[model samples]
Target: MLIRNPDISMSKANTVPFGIWPRLRRETCLDSGSSLGYASLVRNDCEKQRQIPVQLSKLSEKTTLLALVLGATLICGLPLLLLFKTGLTGNGGLDLGPLMEAVQSRSVRSALWHSVESSFLSALAATALGTLLALLIGLTDIRAKGLLVFLILLPMMIPPHVTAIAWIQALGPGSPVLRWLGLAPELGSTHPLYSREGLVLLLTLQHSPLVFLLVRAALRSFPRELSDAARVSGSGSLLMLRRITLPLLAPSLLAGFALAFVAALGNFGINALIGIPARYTTLPVLVWRRLASFGPDVLPNVAVISVILAVVALAAILLQGVLQRHLRTSLIGLPQDPLAIALGGKRPLVEATLWLFVAFVLLLPTASLLATSLVRTYGLPLSAETLTLENFTEVLWRQSVTLRAFANSTLVAGVAALVIAVISLFLAYFLAHRKPAHRTWASLALTQSEVAFAVPGLVMSIAFILAFIRPLPLLNISLYGTLWIILIAYVSVFLAVGLKPVAAAFLQMDGSLEDAARVAGAGFYRRMTRIFTPLAAPAAASGAILVFLTAYNEVTVSALLWSTGNETIGTTIFNYEDGGYTTLAAAMSVVVVAATILIMLTMNALARRVPAGTIPWKD
Candidate 1:
């Protein structure tokens, strides 16, 4: 329950700008603490004599939250209904025969099994690496920690296929790294990168940051007191970690693992580039090959697979929600304790090992991309002699599909990001005012968002085709192969990704200001625009950046949804990779990475503008 300080006055003297509110949470437990604090603040009127009942405030919040939930449900549910209606009307409504036969196919089963196996291995590996990296960077006193953190997260900016290409180039025969290691020609045609193991390695390196970021965030609230208590009980650091820290961090680990797993499962670019050539057929590759090879014959099977994958992903997300709920219930009541486990004799060695591990896992792939971008050689043994700006220059001058793809990606992704930001801000605002009604609504919204994450890119694209193709004939709108379809796909894919951060930010905010605004006769829009939006700038900006980056770097959905005329960075890179244009792909990847970094920097700046402690809206 939120504590309300009745003694405090809501007057001109106390009314500050939007930034001062969040700081107050750090100071006053009376007015800013607990769910009850919010209702009290809302009820605290100089003109009113009596206190507001807790049940009434909760009921009001619940009602408001339900309305928001209903709105989101309509937005998400209608499109899906339309999609299915179109799919059924065009063909035979629901055809199971083809799908069933496809599922029974040996090749289909192999592909499914391989996809699951690769995704699981890669996700687990990424989780381990990400957790260790987060601990090293966030918990330990590492040198150049900030720079190292940036380096570690750099691979995430590069698309999986691009990373695969860069690695293949670097580690392949006569590549710079291979030559440096004195294992040039003897490496033969056997590349470690063009196999299932290679795909797993690439995915793990590329996706580990998802784990690292979430884990790092979780680590922030970890009190050292638990460790102190454990030590006082005569437990060593290792034992204390085993008994205490791990348990506390379990929810975070689960959240990260779930996300990484979904990412791996849905990944298409990495599988296309690395897994396909080695005859290692994953579900995504199989889906793409089927559609490209067999057309709509594999439609139902694709749908079944897509739906199944989405269900699995939804289950993971649901599990995360359950785990997070458990964590909050179990851990939120615990007091903050910042006690540290002393490293004793092995601190330096442990630190060094962690640093080296991070460097190798995070730095190497990015460095390879950057290194290859500056070079003209596609074969290997890249040297200063082979280094040039030709690749970058070509991107500027070439009137190829790559350039169009870049433009398309930027235009579509930019719009989607902006739209997502606005929607998430409102959703988060509503979520902030919610009580127990929050979980169901948030869960539903999250489930819709998880849809795109579960299905392979090709399968989702196929869904788009089956869903949209017949609609145009009926409506005479001709939406198929248009940018709208692509945009829609992006929104469906990224909505959840954008929502998570914004929801997290909202949860941190004190709800009293919103209540006060309501009491002051402010309508919902006025309260949201006037009070909440300004304060939530930081989180909104972060969400927008994440959405923008994901959209910009997206390969899977774009590859499937994009028509010949409609190109995206992913499609461009995929084409280049397909044609064995390795250096060009590296150059394109470099461009994407640069763009992501610029956007992130912009987000950071936006976050700093309404600095906390300066504005009342910070509440």
Candidate 2:
């Protein structure tokens, strides 16, 4: 009744029999060159089975894909294009005056320089640190690899502003955690993390997880033949690593660097909270100050500076993509596990050091945040008497803005997640199963999504402001300062995050299932609902969860878009700290961190349902 294929498990075969494939009287055979060689599904012997005509039952995939592309362009393209037009041109010709003045201004120049210097240095640090972690956890026999990876990725999930806040409390003069450790800096002395060095340190900590993810993905996807050949030629571990593996990892390293650089360059929370006190400024903070101080009157001038920031960010990402394309080497295998060499006696020491680093990076700061949250006041030392839960209670129950922010964040993020999930499901299907002529359209949509995500959230917000500050043409309704703008920006900016896993899941699927359903006279919607949805449901669910977690905690996307009653949790906490309500900020941040962890754990429970590597933290 069945043709056995060693490459594909019986469970997978069971998934493909959605229709009457088994009813065919023909013999089954396997194709060796099939994707992943899922031989059981490659039954070319069923040629007669596929000859059935179902023309009228076929769906309009082209029209659907075209509509998706147009929608993607509206979401991702028009805003930035409008922002550029507003900045680079006026009612007449080229508006070189404002652009030139922005560049020539002393403060603007200094901010630009600071941004470049800090991002470069931090990216360098992140690359090194993340590479080491990836190599250790990915390729070596480090103990508790699952634990290590989770810890490594944990910091990335925590927002940059929260990291800044935690570290400030961790290292500050009045820090309860530092005081408890007897390592507190003396009161009245300038806080150490309030300088350029401090900004770089915090940024490196914040963005290193991104590098870790990219580098580890590269390591996992690398071909093993290189390592095997080196070993057969009598190369030791270090020699092979230096000469073979590291050289092959150059593309990943450069990619990690670029991502880290762009993340740090566009960072707002650290630049604001730390840079302001130290008299240092960066582009994002400068944009915020100018816009916040002058409001819509200075929107055009701010647009000029935003254009410069956006250009730099885009250039770095584009350069990396070009270089990675040139440098990338295809693996002989579609997917395989990386080698896990034994560490011998050094395992204990490596494990200890790794855990120590995790403690400093994640645990220490989290502990500091908790301590800060428990305090009755900002500078008060923690004690049995001074300890209080009033801050949490106040934010969770008493404060109207806090309550409203919670509601708004939940509403917007949930709606965005749902919307993105549906769009990604269809887009992924088209991208993975399209005709040859339609490949470009699918890639075009993906590219636009990538371009939107590559730029800083700060810049995206400015673009949205320029694009939507005025009322809609026909509707005569303004989206500016509304929750809808934040939702739209979230959908546009985070489409990439939601699309990746769904696309990956689609790529792994056998197109033959859809073909069989069609041959059975099943319509497009029927095949999709009955066949593809069940298989990809787990991945789509995970993608939606990721989008929700990302958008829910974001401050930058809504930084400019949020208004009186439309505050998000991130903005609320930021405002609290900015307005000298540190205890409430810390309390709210703790709650956010807890909520993020809970959501992440929920996603982890879906790990088995999705493909490997879909859940980033899960091994």
Candidate 3:
């Protein structure tokens, strides 16, 4: 506020910043008859005070953001860089000898071939199934579409290893459902899922939901007018779809395929638990086996393989980006409500088939998992006489490893979530509302995270082993087999997950509130705490919860990183199944799946409060 009538003798010069005093001196004009420039002096002083806080606040924020970005870049980028360095030149300076030799090795070549074959086959299957479902659900007036979409996506939410365990129980000789229906295989016969075809099947099942999500989103933006015009011109539905709809959707379908392929290529759980018995070896499984069986003695060889796998995944992503750009179709108008094609006379049949497929996908594994968890032993039938709570009790209460793993995963995931949330809150702010003068470093950090995420978790695990196997430079502390390494890796790998919703929230906010606050002399912290934080908290929490869920159940990243005491929940369950403790694995998986469902349901309850796109399965 300014004083309208100050005495001519008054001076507020000393209150202003340096150089402003000389400027104020030139503005002041003393007069005995009036207050002269007194009003201007006070007004200028008030303006200067307001501007000083803003300048200092921005300086403080910029300095902090730089420090944070530097830390983020190191955490996210350093490991991958070291991984490439070791893989490329560990043998000698600027040498390609080791990488070439490793890639050419018989075992390495076989694994690489297997990886590509399985990924390609599974990706094709996933794309076909997912695209069909997307069209049926998104473009047609299907009953229970929301519930159906959510149910269809549940497999994606379940950890791949868990899915593997459930399917094994569902179709094996001892399968409760099969036995109850008198359809069980011979007791001595080998399990069905322990084969190459089975590997591809599980991979397809695990990844189809990803394709569904992407293709459905694309379908939602499809031009309804084109479909109406085609129909009006007497084009049949199938023909029109083949000629128009599919062509427009080609880019999204390609992206879906690439995503599924990369996901399958780096898949660890299925490749290990299923492929190993099937005599199928993918690169991810090969890397895990090499390191686990041989330890760090074979780290250099492992690094080379990891680099190859990373290159394949990144290459697929880059190719998708290029092809998508080339295939992009520009629409002239805003996207309308999604196409709602009437299924007409065949609606009942189509709906019944969809329900049947959903049942086969969801109920079989879920029921088998519950039956296994309730039984006393792995092969025991789930009759009332055979049922017991011992398996759940053993894993949840009696077993030290399982209990420790639960605690370890909880602590690491919770800490990682909180850390990522805080970083995302500000990092997204800078990115979403960037100033020209803001450092380019924030974007560099963001890029590192995106790259880290795109690279497989198995590959990132190798990077961590290479980066942290040695004691750190300043601290002289080794993080190689420690939970801190997992924490850091999680923060690096899942940062993009945490950044997305907050960034979306930031983009949606009205800047007028902040401008008004700034005029009222609000500092950066005040504006952030009072305005921005409240506005973005729901979204930040959603992102953090997403990060926690992802990192908590993920076995791929922690498979190679887990030591005895620091075993994560995913690794512990995986090890149990690998060690022939099927009942224990099923019990633990049941707990994890239940928790995941509950959390997702909770998020759905709050979805209306957060920005869209945060909850993938939500409408």
TM-scores of the candidates in the order shown: 0.80, 0.88, 0.89
Q: Which runs of model 1 end up more than 4 angstroms from their true locations?
A: 1-75, 78-96, 185-187, 294-298, 315-329, 332-340, 374-377, 383-385, 434-446, 452-456, 471-475, 601-619
Whole-model lDDT for model 1 versus the true structure? 0.69
Distance from true position, residue 133, model 1, in Å?
2.2
Candidate with more favorable, higher TM-score: 1 or 3 = 3
TM-score of 2: 0.88
Rank order (by TM-score, best first): 3, 2, 1
Per-residue lDDT tens digits for candidate 3, residues 283-350, read 99889878877865588888889999999998988999999999998876666788778889989999
Q: Model 1 compared with the native: what TM-score? A: 0.80
Regions of model 3 farther than 4 Å from truth: 1-51, 434-440, 508-521, 607-614
1 or 3, greater by lDDT: 3
Candidate 1, residues 453-491, lDDT tens digits: the string is: 454556567666766665565567866788888987787
Query: Against the true structure, whose TM-score is highest?
Result: 3
Q: Clashing residue pairs, candidate 2?
A: none
When summed lDDT is taken over every stretch of 10 residues in candidate 2, the lowest stretch is: 23-32
